[model samples]
Target: MKDIKAIAMYLPQFHRIPENDQWWGKGFTEWTAAKAAEKLFQGHYQPREPLNDNYYDLMQKKTMEEQADLALKYGLDGFCFYHYYFKNGRRVLEKPAENLLKWNDINMPFCFCWDNTSWARSWSKLGSKLTWFDKEKERVYDGNGVLLEQKYGREKEWEEHFNYLLPFFQDDRYIKVDNKPVFLIYRTDEMACFTEMIDYWRKLAKIENLEGIFILGVNSCNEKIGMDGILFSGPSAYWNPIISSNHIEYENRNGIKCFDYETIWKNVMIAGSKKNVKTYFGGFVDYDDTPRRGSQGVAFINTSVEIFEEYLYKLACKNLSQNNELLFINAFNEWGEGMYLEPDKKRKYAFLEAIKTVKEKLESVVQDDNEELTSALKANKGLSGNVEVINTNMEKQNGKFKEYYFLLHRWLQLKEENKNLSKYFMDHGYYRIAIYGLGVMGKHLIEELKNTEIRLLYAIDRNPQLIYPDFEIRSVDDDFPRTDAIVVTATFEYDVIWNELKKKVDYPIVSLAHVLNEM
Candidate 1:
């Protein structure tokens, strides 16, 4: 069976924009709100902190590359960026997407979701006070009291919109379904001329010599709007009534709601079972928009890493049965909304690990089943001949399958053990270290070292041309730094690197696999 596609909803609001600077303050970004958040009630977690301990600017290409690496490591199929476009070709928070397009080496598949709602200045009293009022008092602006209105203009603007997205659709990395570029409309019902817009976009796509667009409606509004599929937003949208009843209400806090996180997960699973439409369910690590909403923030309380893992496993199984093979995560990094999957101070990469665990487990089961494997291979290659040979070989090798399973089990165990070994080395004064091979495994090892006291001296690679902004890549034959130790991160040529390094240097050498095996 094919692996389930997991697309995370990505927010590009981490960069500075002129509109945001004017509205908020100089150099203002999402972190401003996120850092300012305070606990609204007892036992309520607030002021969420990133594991990196720095507010990353999205303008940096390195940040985007690291994000892509993390997403791929966790088995995410792609990202659905929240594309913000207002009337008259106006756009905000577009640099990240543009940068992704420009830097071809990022290597992450991507699509767009037109957040077709009007931009409102509702998070603060200063922005919303002037535009919205009730009896001389400021009223809560419900996202529609727009500062910049969203207008669906005539054919010219529609053509312009399609033209703007044409380049992205043409990109090889763009995510598609059945040869059609996948686009999402966040608020399909809000646009009166959505049908016309869809038709125009589809017509434009055909003119560009492409198949029709796979336009999906977000939330429960897809039914009313004639979308090809529905992408559920999150649990809050589906179980609001249950949440409201079980939640805590605060005095003078604008009816801030708080619900048991586990209860929400249970309700979501129950609701998912009854769904019949072609839909993609969303899974969230946690949610608490108090940073943006302040006193009016709603949160799913008691949401631990373990709870999130369970929720993800259930959601993954549900998606597999639904046959959509797509599971949309609520967010990659909506830090202000407290729904991000990025590593945080409280739970560093725990959410990401949960995703990886579920995906690997599910995929492993499929691969281990001989019938499923044969079927998958036949379907993938459109093979009609000599499948018997493959099946015979699989059956003959069945007795040795236990060894393969054991190796797989050891590999998974080593992943965790290697992480602990990294910490041990750091604690024992292995601060200066050189990593061999600047591959995916090296990147993962680098991330592990970030939490420790280790300092990377150089990234050694066989190919000297391989460049990474995060570290200086040097050829293995280059002069070595007087390092405390050398850690080999190459899996394919581990023995080759180890033998070659042992010939040149007398420093304490350790391979990642060696450390894991020792543990």
Candidate 2:
């Protein structure tokens, strides 16, 4: 099976710039807004803090090295940095990428995504605030007035833009598809003379003796716009129908809308399966832009680490099954937007662990299947002489025997693993424990522990509708019965459940796979 390349969108607004200093005050950066954010509603998590208070400055080269190491460790392919370029050779937030190019020791794959939208002052209260450094002196409010235009200039400007990117395209660490350097346009439809701009870039690449660019149009409603491919933004729009059907009233606090992350994820899975376009799907870890927009910030509630894992797993599997090898995450360190995968104070390394676990499990499935088949064949060969002859004939006459053997082998493996896991709990003095999933794995685990000394606390699942005759099914968000530890039974989402449990309880959480492997 071809390995999936997971690329995360990167934002470079963490470091200070001259334009920002003049507009927002001296030493101003994304951290300023993030630190000053207030909770707009009850249960709203605001002022998101990083793990170990690592409020890193992007200007420091060590910070970039640490980020690259963390991303590679978690199975990410690279980062598509959001590049900000405006009309007349103006650029903002270009220091990070420039610095990255200068540092040869930092080894990480990377690409670019042009944020082609015009910059405006809508980040604050829309109509109430005027842009601080508007050269035009336009007092227009509602944040729609352009502070900087994205005009498609003549040949000179186009050449300048392409020349600026030629070095990056030639770099060994740049990401490519079919030898073409991959680039993304944030909003293709919004750009003026889109086709001309792309043609110019391609011409420049050919002139430089490099492969042509593989440009993709992002958030284009799955439409082709003279680019190599399209990329679905995320659950933001795909789940609109489900959100509407639920009849949930979302209060537009300031300009921000509220929605449920679980609801969106469930719908996203359904939508993902129905997609017919050969496009890359993006996943959102958690979104609460309160740090940037405050009361006007959009937030997705009930976004536990478990939901994110399941969502990404299903999406990744879908992409692999469809033979598409690219998967884009919304962000790597979009702390201001609250969609970051970096370690945070409340859930350190949870998101990163989810990505690693899903990738490892999916990649191991085919190998495990082969191992099982080999063992079954060995066992069959060891049978009696008459039985071996009959089995061979049966395998030739009908393939059903092989299917039956595979099923039986899987059942026996699950039984043995569950038994070992139950013993592990007992050996560790964990008499009272809670199972964190209610799917097939959970059922097997419950059956294995039924006769053991381990007392079963209430079962926890994200689905509130799930029920069991012997025990009550409680939601992960609810206050459940206390236990010594939580055993995550869902094999595919073990890390996700463990991350969620760690935040809620202080017990030593364990996964079924870990227990079985140890035994």
Q: Candidate 1 regions off by >4 Å?
A: 122-145, 222-226, 241-255, 272-277, 368-519
Per-residue error for 424 in candidate 1, Å, reads: 71
Query: How many clashes show up in model 2?
Result: 0
Model 1 worst lDDT run, 10 consecutive residues: 125-134
Error of 1 at 75 (Å): 1.8
lDDT for residue 190 in candidate 2, whole number 0-100? 35
TM-score of 1: 0.64
Tens digits of per-residue lDDT, candidate 1, 1-519, equal: 556788898989898888765556666688878878877777777889999796899999999888999999988888999998888889888899999999999988999999876666553211232321112233333443446656666568989989999999999999998888999887553343455467668888898999989887776332432357777667665463321122333233335777677877765554432122366667777888778766556777778888888778666665655556578888899888888889999888989998888788778866675554444434423321223244234322542343234334545655644545565575446779988877666776787677667788888888999988777888977888778988886543443465577678877666654443333
Model 2 scores worst on lDDT over the 10 consecutive residues at 124-133
The total of clashing pairs for model 1 equals 0
Give the per-residue lDDT digits (tens) of candidate 2, residues 1-519. Answer: 566789999989889887776566777787777777767777778879889989889999999999999999998889999998887878999999999899967987999999876666753211233323222243433344446655555468889988888888888898998898989887554342455467668888888987799887775432333467767656564544421122334656546687778877655444432122355657778887777665555788778999899778767765555456678888898877788999999999999999999778667763564554344334323321223234333323333333234333544655654544567787777899888888776787788778778888778888989879988889888986678877776544343455466678866676554454334
Clashing pairs in 1: none
